[model samples]
Target chain A: SQKIEQNSEALNIQEGKTATLTCNYTNYSPAYLQWYRQDPGRGPVFLLLIRENEKEKRKERLKVTFDTTLKQSLFHITASQPADSATYLCAYNAGNMFTFGGGTRLMVKP
Target chain B: NAGVTQTPKFRVLKTGQSMTLLCAQDMNHEYMYWYRQDPGMGLRLIHYSVGEGTTAKGEVPDGYNVSRLKKQNFLLGLESAAPSQTSVYFCASRSQGTGELFFGEGSRLTVL
Candidate 1:
Protein backbone atom coordinates (compact mmCIF):
# COMPACT_ATOMS: atom_id res chain seq x y z
CA SER A 1 0.00 0.00 0.00
CA GLN A 2 1.18 3.50 -0.77
CA LYS A 3 1.20 6.07 1.99
CA ILE A 4 1.54 9.82 1.73
CA GLU A 5 2.87 11.74 4.69
CA GLN A 6 2.87 15.48 5.26
CA ASN A 7 3.84 17.54 8.26
CA SER A 8 0.83 17.68 10.52
CA GLU A 9 2.16 20.68 12.43
CA ALA A 10 1.15 24.15 11.36
CA LEU A 11 3.89 26.11 9.62
CA ASN A 12 4.10 29.76 10.57
CA ILE A 13 5.99 32.13 8.31
CA GLN A 14 6.28 35.88 7.95
CA GLU A 15 4.40 37.36 5.09
CA GLY A 16 6.46 37.86 1.90
CA LYS A 17 8.73 34.95 2.87
CA THR A 18 9.00 31.65 1.15
CA ALA A 19 7.01 28.78 2.68
CA THR A 20 8.18 25.26 2.01
CA LEU A 21 6.16 22.13 2.79
CA THR A 22 7.19 18.55 2.37
CA CYS A 23 5.33 15.40 1.32
CA ASN A 24 6.95 12.01 1.60
CA TYR A 25 5.70 8.72 0.29
CA THR A 26 6.46 5.20 1.42
CA ASN A 27 6.08 2.78 -1.47
CA TYR A 28 6.35 2.87 -5.23
CA SER A 29 6.89 6.20 -6.87
CA PRO A 30 3.81 7.79 -8.35
CA ALA A 31 3.48 8.82 -11.94
CA TYR A 32 2.60 12.35 -10.89
CA LEU A 33 1.96 14.46 -7.81
CA GLN A 34 -0.32 17.41 -7.15
CA TRP A 35 -0.63 20.20 -4.60
CA TYR A 36 -3.87 21.73 -3.46
CA ARG A 37 -4.84 24.75 -1.36
CA GLN A 38 -7.73 24.37 1.03
CA ASP A 39 -9.13 27.28 2.99
CA PRO A 40 -11.13 26.74 6.12
CA GLY A 41 -14.59 25.30 5.47
CA ARG A 42 -13.89 24.87 1.78
CA GLY A 43 -12.90 22.15 -0.59
CA PRO A 44 -9.37 21.95 -1.90
CA VAL A 45 -8.39 23.87 -5.02
CA PHE A 46 -5.74 22.60 -7.41
CA LEU A 47 -2.49 24.58 -7.30
CA LEU A 48 0.09 22.64 -9.28
CA LEU A 49 1.01 19.22 -10.62
CA ILE A 50 4.40 17.72 -11.40
CA ARG A 51 5.03 14.53 -13.26
CA GLU A 52 7.60 11.94 -12.36
CA ASN A 53 9.64 12.71 -15.44
CA GLU A 54 9.68 16.39 -14.62
CA LYS A 55 11.99 17.65 -11.92
CA GLU A 56 10.01 20.78 -11.12
CA LYS A 57 7.02 22.81 -12.16
CA ARG A 58 6.09 26.39 -11.45
CA LYS A 59 2.90 28.38 -11.64
CA GLU A 60 3.29 32.06 -10.89
CA ARG A 61 4.60 32.23 -7.32
CA LEU A 62 3.94 28.54 -6.62
CA LYS A 63 6.43 25.82 -7.42
CA VAL A 64 6.45 22.06 -6.93
CA THR A 65 9.36 19.67 -7.16
CA PHE A 66 9.17 15.90 -7.40
CA ASP A 67 12.15 13.78 -6.48
CA THR A 68 11.54 10.15 -7.35
CA THR A 69 14.81 9.05 -5.79
CA LEU A 70 13.94 10.65 -2.48
CA LYS A 71 10.27 9.65 -2.73
CA GLN A 72 9.38 13.18 -1.69
CA SER A 73 7.75 16.24 -3.16
CA LEU A 74 8.33 19.75 -1.97
CA PHE A 75 5.83 22.57 -2.38
CA HIS A 76 7.07 26.14 -2.20
CA ILE A 77 5.10 29.33 -2.18
CA THR A 78 7.29 32.36 -2.96
CA ALA A 79 6.49 35.85 -1.80
CA SER A 80 3.62 34.41 0.19
CA GLN A 81 1.07 36.83 1.59
CA PRO A 82 -1.41 36.77 4.44
CA ALA A 83 -4.05 35.67 1.98
CA ASP A 84 -1.94 32.64 1.16
CA SER A 85 -2.60 31.15 4.59
CA ALA A 86 -4.35 27.84 4.15
CA THR A 87 -3.98 24.12 4.52
CA TYR A 88 -1.84 22.60 1.77
CA LEU A 89 -2.31 19.00 0.72
CA CYS A 90 -0.21 16.75 -1.48
CA ALA A 91 -1.60 13.85 -3.45
CA TYR A 92 -0.15 11.33 -5.86
CA ASN A 93 -1.40 8.93 -8.50
CA ALA A 94 0.14 5.49 -8.58
CA GLY A 95 -1.37 2.46 -10.22
CA ASN A 96 -4.30 4.68 -11.08
CA MET A 97 -4.97 5.28 -7.38
CA PHE A 98 -4.99 8.73 -5.88
CA THR A 99 -3.86 9.08 -2.28
CA PHE A 100 -3.62 12.27 -0.24
CA GLY A 101 -1.51 13.29 2.70
CA GLY A 102 -2.74 14.62 6.03
CA GLY A 103 -1.82 18.13 4.93
CA THR A 104 0.17 20.95 6.52
CA ARG A 105 -1.58 24.08 7.70
CA LEU A 106 0.27 27.23 6.68
CA MET A 107 -0.11 30.48 8.57
CA VAL A 108 1.39 33.55 6.99
CA LYS A 109 1.62 36.28 9.59
CA PRO A 110 1.86 39.92 8.71
CA ASN B 1 -20.85 26.17 -14.85
CA ALA B 2 -21.36 24.19 -11.69
CA GLY B 3 -18.33 22.02 -12.25
CA VAL B 4 -19.23 19.70 -9.42
CA THR B 5 -22.23 20.14 -7.10
CA GLN B 6 -23.13 18.15 -4.01
CA THR B 7 -26.59 18.18 -2.56
CA PRO B 8 -27.55 18.47 1.14
CA LYS B 9 -24.63 20.69 2.09
CA PHE B 10 -25.27 19.67 5.69
CA ARG B 11 -26.91 16.51 7.01
CA VAL B 12 -27.54 15.08 10.43
CA LEU B 13 -28.41 11.38 10.70
CA LYS B 14 -29.15 9.11 13.63
CA THR B 15 -27.51 5.78 14.05
CA GLY B 16 -29.15 3.11 11.87
CA GLN B 17 -30.54 5.75 9.60
CA SER B 18 -30.06 5.64 5.84
CA MET B 19 -29.42 8.48 3.44
CA THR B 20 -27.95 9.25 0.09
CA LEU B 21 -25.63 12.01 -1.07
CA LEU B 22 -26.04 13.28 -4.58
CA CYS B 23 -23.26 14.56 -6.83
CA ALA B 24 -23.80 16.23 -10.16
CA GLN B 25 -21.35 17.47 -12.71
CA ASP B 26 -21.81 19.28 -16.00
CA MET B 27 -18.29 19.12 -17.30
CA ASN B 28 -18.87 15.85 -19.12
CA HIS B 29 -16.01 14.27 -17.27
CA GLU B 30 -15.33 10.57 -17.44
CA TYR B 31 -14.07 10.06 -13.93
CA MET B 32 -15.93 10.78 -10.70
CA TYR B 33 -14.99 10.08 -7.10
CA TRP B 34 -16.31 10.27 -3.55
CA TYR B 35 -14.07 11.01 -0.61
CA ARG B 36 -14.48 11.68 3.10
CA GLN B 37 -12.33 14.00 5.18
CA ASP B 38 -11.80 13.74 8.91
CA PRO B 39 -9.80 15.74 11.40
CA GLY B 40 -6.14 14.77 11.45
CA MET B 41 -6.84 12.53 8.46
CA GLY B 42 -6.61 13.44 4.85
CA LEU B 43 -9.26 12.75 2.28
CA ARG B 44 -10.04 9.03 2.00
CA LEU B 45 -11.45 7.65 -1.17
CA ILE B 46 -14.79 5.93 -0.64
CA HIS B 47 -15.79 4.93 -4.14
CA TYR B 48 -15.12 5.95 -7.70
CA SER B 49 -16.57 5.54 -11.15
CA VAL B 50 -14.61 5.52 -14.33
CA GLY B 51 -17.65 5.89 -16.51
CA GLU B 52 -21.38 5.54 -16.46
CA GLY B 53 -22.59 2.21 -15.09
CA THR B 54 -19.17 1.42 -13.72
CA THR B 55 -18.12 1.69 -10.09
CA ALA B 56 -15.22 0.44 -8.01
CA LYS B 57 -14.16 0.43 -4.38
CA GLY B 58 -11.48 2.80 -3.24
CA GLU B 59 -9.31 2.89 -0.13
CA VAL B 60 -12.27 3.11 2.27
CA PRO B 61 -15.39 1.67 0.74
CA ASP B 62 -16.86 0.17 3.87
CA GLY B 63 -20.21 1.42 5.16
CA TYR B 64 -20.97 3.00 1.84
CA ASN B 65 -22.39 2.16 -1.57
CA VAL B 66 -22.32 4.10 -4.81
CA SER B 67 -24.21 4.22 -8.10
CA ARG B 68 -23.50 5.94 -11.36
CA LEU B 69 -26.40 5.19 -13.65
CA LYS B 70 -26.03 8.43 -15.51
CA LYS B 71 -23.00 10.13 -16.86
CA GLN B 72 -23.60 13.36 -14.99
CA ASN B 73 -24.67 12.05 -11.58
CA PHE B 74 -23.05 9.86 -9.00
CA LEU B 75 -24.88 8.76 -5.89
CA LEU B 76 -23.38 7.65 -2.56
CA GLY B 77 -25.57 5.87 -0.05
CA LEU B 78 -25.28 4.88 3.57
CA GLU B 79 -27.43 1.91 4.39
CA SER B 80 -27.03 2.25 8.16
CA ALA B 81 -25.21 5.32 9.35
CA ALA B 82 -22.93 5.13 12.33
CA PRO B 83 -21.20 7.69 14.51
CA SER B 84 -17.92 6.90 12.82
CA GLN B 85 -19.43 7.99 9.52
CA THR B 86 -19.49 11.57 10.64
CA SER B 87 -17.24 13.58 8.35
CA VAL B 88 -17.16 15.94 5.45
CA TYR B 89 -17.83 14.33 2.07
CA PHE B 90 -16.55 15.73 -1.19
CA CYS B 91 -17.37 14.81 -4.77
CA ALA B 92 -14.91 15.34 -7.57
CA SER B 93 -14.73 14.91 -11.34
CA ARG B 94 -11.94 15.00 -13.86
CA SER B 95 -11.41 14.62 -17.53
CA GLN B 96 -9.71 11.67 -19.18
CA GLY B 97 -6.22 13.07 -19.57
CA THR B 98 -6.10 16.16 -17.34
CA GLY B 99 -5.73 14.23 -14.07
CA GLU B 100 -6.80 17.36 -12.23
CA LEU B 101 -9.82 16.91 -9.97
CA PHE B 102 -12.58 19.49 -9.72
CA PHE B 103 -14.30 19.16 -6.38
CA GLY B 104 -17.63 20.20 -4.99
CA GLU B 105 -18.16 22.52 -2.04
CA GLY B 106 -18.62 19.49 0.27
CA SER B 107 -21.33 17.86 2.37
CA ARG B 108 -20.88 17.82 6.09
CA LEU B 109 -22.53 14.79 7.71
CA THR B 110 -23.07 14.25 11.40
CA VAL B 111 -24.27 11.02 12.98
CA LEU B 112 -25.27 10.61 16.58
Candidate 2:
Protein backbone atom coordinates (compact mmCIF):
# COMPACT_ATOMS: atom_id res chain seq x y z
CA SER A 1 0.00 0.00 0.00
CA GLN A 2 1.17 3.50 -0.73
CA LYS A 3 1.55 5.90 2.18
CA ILE A 4 1.62 9.69 2.16
CA GLU A 5 2.91 11.57 5.17
CA GLN A 6 2.85 15.26 5.92
CA ASN A 7 5.67 16.35 8.21
CA SER A 8 3.52 18.39 10.58
CA GLU A 9 0.00 18.44 11.91
CA ALA A 10 -0.12 22.19 12.34
CA LEU A 11 2.00 25.22 11.58
CA ASN A 12 1.74 28.80 12.82
CA ILE A 13 3.46 31.73 11.17
CA GLN A 14 3.42 35.51 11.48
CA GLU A 15 1.60 37.27 8.70
CA GLY A 16 3.92 38.34 5.86
CA LYS A 17 6.34 35.54 6.66
CA THR A 18 6.79 32.57 4.43
CA ALA A 19 5.19 29.31 5.54
CA THR A 20 6.57 26.02 4.41
CA LEU A 21 5.02 22.57 4.75
CA THR A 22 6.42 19.19 3.80
CA CYS A 23 4.97 16.00 2.37
CA ASN A 24 6.86 12.72 2.22
CA TYR A 25 5.86 9.49 0.59
CA THR A 26 7.11 5.95 0.94
CA ASN A 27 7.12 2.93 -1.40
CA TYR A 28 6.09 4.76 -4.54
CA SER A 29 7.35 7.08 -7.24
CA PRO A 30 4.42 9.14 -8.34
CA ALA A 31 4.51 10.81 -11.73
CA TYR A 32 2.97 13.96 -10.31
CA LEU A 33 1.99 15.50 -6.97
CA GLN A 34 -0.78 17.95 -6.15
CA TRP A 35 -1.44 20.52 -3.45
CA TYR A 36 -4.81 21.63 -2.13
CA ARG A 37 -6.25 24.05 0.40
CA GLN A 38 -8.97 22.89 2.74
CA ASP A 39 -10.88 25.13 5.05
CA PRO A 40 -12.66 24.02 8.18
CA GLY A 41 -15.81 22.07 7.40
CA ARG A 42 -15.20 22.44 3.70
CA GLY A 43 -13.83 20.16 1.03
CA PRO A 44 -10.39 20.70 -0.42
CA VAL A 45 -9.71 23.08 -3.31
CA PHE A 46 -7.00 22.31 -5.83
CA LEU A 47 -4.01 24.62 -5.62
CA LEU A 48 -1.15 23.36 -7.75
CA LEU A 49 0.31 20.30 -9.43
CA ILE A 50 3.94 19.43 -10.10
CA ARG A 51 5.03 16.63 -12.35
CA GLU A 52 7.99 14.34 -11.69
CA ASN A 53 9.83 15.90 -14.60
CA GLU A 54 9.26 19.33 -13.19
CA LYS A 55 11.19 20.38 -10.14
CA GLU A 56 9.18 23.44 -9.18
CA LYS A 57 5.89 25.16 -9.89
CA ARG A 58 4.48 28.46 -8.67
CA LYS A 59 1.18 30.23 -8.72
CA GLU A 60 0.71 33.70 -7.27
CA ARG A 61 1.89 33.48 -3.67
CA LEU A 62 2.08 29.72 -3.65
CA LYS A 63 4.92 27.43 -4.78
CA VAL A 64 5.40 23.67 -4.81
CA THR A 65 8.54 21.63 -5.29
CA PHE A 66 8.76 17.93 -6.00
CA ASP A 67 11.87 15.88 -5.27
CA THR A 68 11.30 12.39 -6.61
CA THR A 69 14.69 11.25 -5.32
CA LEU A 70 13.83 12.22 -1.76
CA LYS A 71 10.22 11.15 -2.19
CA GLN A 72 9.24 14.52 -0.78
CA SER A 73 7.35 17.61 -1.80
CA LEU A 74 7.47 21.02 -0.21
CA PHE A 75 4.64 23.55 -0.33
CA HIS A 76 5.35 27.20 0.34
CA ILE A 77 3.11 30.19 0.76
CA THR A 78 5.08 33.39 0.41
CA ALA A 79 4.05 36.69 2.00
CA SER A 80 1.41 34.80 3.83
CA GLN A 81 -1.73 36.59 4.93
CA PRO A 82 -4.17 35.89 7.74
CA ALA A 83 -6.59 34.75 5.09
CA ASP A 84 -4.09 32.09 4.07
CA SER A 85 -4.86 30.09 7.18
CA ALA A 86 -6.20 26.67 6.28
CA THR A 87 -5.25 23.03 6.16
CA TYR A 88 -3.14 22.14 3.15
CA LEU A 89 -3.00 18.67 1.69
CA CYS A 90 -0.44 16.97 -0.55
CA ALA A 91 -1.46 14.27 -2.95
CA TYR A 92 0.44 11.85 -5.19
CA ASN A 93 -0.84 10.27 -8.33
CA ALA A 94 0.19 7.03 -10.04
CA GLY A 95 -1.71 6.37 -13.24
CA ASN A 96 -5.33 6.83 -12.12
CA MET A 97 -4.60 6.12 -8.48
CA PHE A 98 -4.33 8.93 -5.97
CA THR A 99 -3.16 9.18 -2.35
CA PHE A 100 -3.36 12.11 0.03
CA GLY A 101 -1.41 13.22 3.06
CA GLY A 102 -2.98 13.90 6.46
CA GLY A 103 -2.49 17.62 5.80
CA THR A 104 -0.91 20.43 7.78
CA ARG A 105 -3.15 23.09 9.33
CA LEU A 106 -1.57 26.48 8.79
CA MET A 107 -2.35 29.54 10.86
CA VAL A 108 -1.03 32.92 9.84
CA LYS A 109 -1.43 35.50 12.59
CA PRO A 110 -1.11 39.24 12.44
CA ASN B 1 -21.49 26.40 -13.07
CA ALA B 2 -22.02 24.09 -10.12
CA GLY B 3 -18.81 22.22 -10.84
CA VAL B 4 -19.78 19.47 -8.45
CA THR B 5 -22.64 19.11 -5.96
CA GLN B 6 -23.30 16.55 -3.21
CA THR B 7 -26.72 15.99 -1.78
CA PRO B 8 -27.65 15.64 1.88
CA LYS B 9 -24.92 17.85 3.31
CA PHE B 10 -25.38 16.21 6.69
CA ARG B 11 -26.88 12.97 7.95
CA VAL B 12 -27.12 10.81 11.05
CA LEU B 13 -27.56 7.09 10.49
CA LYS B 14 -28.33 4.41 13.01
CA THR B 15 -26.31 1.25 12.94
CA GLY B 16 -27.28 -1.08 10.12
CA GLN B 17 -29.07 1.69 8.27
CA SER B 18 -28.59 2.10 4.53
CA MET B 19 -28.29 5.34 2.57
CA THR B 20 -26.92 6.68 -0.65
CA LEU B 21 -24.90 9.84 -1.20
CA LEU B 22 -25.44 11.51 -4.54
CA CYS B 23 -22.78 13.35 -6.47
CA ALA B 24 -23.45 15.40 -9.57
CA GLN B 25 -21.08 17.24 -11.83
CA ASP B 26 -21.98 19.56 -14.66
CA MET B 27 -18.49 19.75 -16.05
CA ASN B 28 -19.03 16.70 -18.23
CA HIS B 29 -15.93 15.10 -16.81
CA GLU B 30 -14.81 11.57 -17.49
CA TYR B 31 -13.71 10.69 -13.96
CA MET B 32 -15.40 10.89 -10.57
CA TYR B 33 -14.30 9.85 -7.12
CA TRP B 34 -15.62 9.40 -3.59
CA TYR B 35 -13.44 10.10 -0.58
CA ARG B 36 -13.88 10.18 3.19
CA GLN B 37 -12.03 12.46 5.57
CA ASP B 38 -11.45 11.63 9.22
CA PRO B 39 -9.66 13.54 11.95
CA GLY B 40 -5.88 13.43 11.41
CA MET B 41 -6.40 11.12 8.44
CA GLY B 42 -6.65 13.16 5.31
CA LEU B 43 -8.97 12.07 2.58
CA ARG B 44 -9.07 8.38 1.79
CA LEU B 45 -10.35 7.17 -1.54
CA ILE B 46 -13.26 4.83 -1.17
CA HIS B 47 -14.25 4.31 -4.79
CA TYR B 48 -13.71 5.88 -8.18
CA SER B 49 -15.05 5.74 -11.70
CA VAL B 50 -13.02 6.27 -14.83
CA GLY B 51 -16.09 6.73 -16.97
CA GLU B 52 -19.74 5.93 -17.19
CA GLY B 53 -20.47 2.30 -16.37
CA THR B 54 -16.99 1.76 -14.98
CA THR B 55 -16.11 1.66 -11.30
CA ALA B 56 -13.21 0.44 -9.20
CA LYS B 57 -12.33 0.07 -5.54
CA GLY B 58 -9.88 2.48 -4.01
CA GLU B 59 -7.65 2.35 -0.96
CA VAL B 60 -10.58 2.20 1.50
CA PRO B 61 -13.51 0.67 -0.32
CA ASP B 62 -14.80 -1.58 2.40
CA GLY B 63 -18.42 -1.16 3.58
CA TYR B 64 -19.24 1.01 0.59
CA ASN B 65 -20.58 0.45 -2.91
CA VAL B 66 -20.62 2.84 -5.84
CA SER B 67 -22.43 3.11 -9.13
CA ARG B 68 -21.85 5.42 -12.06
CA LEU B 69 -24.54 4.73 -14.57
CA LYS B 70 -24.56 8.30 -15.78
CA LYS B 71 -21.54 10.29 -16.89
CA GLN B 72 -22.45 13.22 -14.67
CA ASN B 73 -23.52 11.44 -11.54
CA PHE B 74 -21.87 9.00 -9.14
CA LEU B 75 -23.69 7.43 -6.21
CA LEU B 76 -22.06 6.03 -3.08
CA GLY B 77 -24.12 3.72 -0.92
CA LEU B 78 -23.57 2.64 2.64
CA GLU B 79 -25.31 -0.64 3.26
CA SER B 80 -25.57 -1.38 6.99
CA ALA B 81 -23.58 1.48 8.34
CA ALA B 82 -21.51 1.38 11.53
CA PRO B 83 -20.08 3.93 13.95
CA SER B 84 -16.65 3.52 12.44
CA GLN B 85 -18.09 4.72 9.15
CA THR B 86 -18.67 8.23 10.46
CA SER B 87 -16.73 10.73 8.42
CA VAL B 88 -17.05 13.61 6.00
CA TYR B 89 -17.61 12.38 2.47
CA PHE B 90 -16.53 14.38 -0.56
CA CYS B 91 -17.32 13.83 -4.22
CA ALA B 92 -14.97 15.10 -6.86
CA SER B 93 -14.61 15.17 -10.63
CA ARG B 94 -11.77 15.87 -13.00
CA SER B 95 -11.35 16.17 -16.69
CA GLN B 96 -9.48 13.60 -18.73
CA GLY B 97 -5.96 14.99 -18.36
CA THR B 98 -5.94 18.03 -16.07
CA GLY B 99 -5.62 16.09 -12.81
CA GLU B 100 -7.26 19.05 -11.12
CA LEU B 101 -10.20 17.80 -9.11
CA PHE B 102 -13.26 19.90 -8.38
CA PHE B 103 -14.76 18.86 -5.05
CA GLY B 104 -18.22 19.24 -3.64
CA GLU B 105 -19.10 20.91 -0.33
CA GLY B 106 -18.83 17.49 1.38
CA SER B 107 -21.45 15.35 3.16
CA ARG B 108 -20.94 14.90 6.89
CA LEU B 109 -22.21 11.56 8.17
CA THR B 110 -22.53 10.59 11.82
CA VAL B 111 -23.24 6.94 12.47
CA LEU B 112 -24.54 6.08 15.90
The candidate that achieves the highest TM-score relative to the unseen native structure: 1
Off-target runs (Cα >4 Å) in candidate 1 are none
Clashing residue pairs found in predicted model 2: none
**Worst-scoring 10-residue span by lDDT in model 2 chain A:** A1-10
On a 0 to 100 scale, what is the lDDT of residue B65 in model 1?
A: 98
* Number of clashing residue pairs, candidate 1: 0
Clashing residue pairs for model 1 = none
Off by over 4 Å in 2: none
TM-score of chain B of 2: 0.98
Best by lDDT: 1
| Model 1 chain A: lowest-lDDT 10 consecutive positions | A91-100
Error of 1 at A24 (Å): 0.5
Please, what are the lDDT tens digits per residue for candidate 2 over residues A1-110? 67889966579999999999999999877888999999998889999999989999999999999888898999999999999999999998767867889899999999
Please estimate how well model 2 matches the true structure, expressed as its whole-model Cα lDDT.
0.93
Candidate 1 local lDDT, residue A20 = 99
TM-score of each: 0.98, 0.97
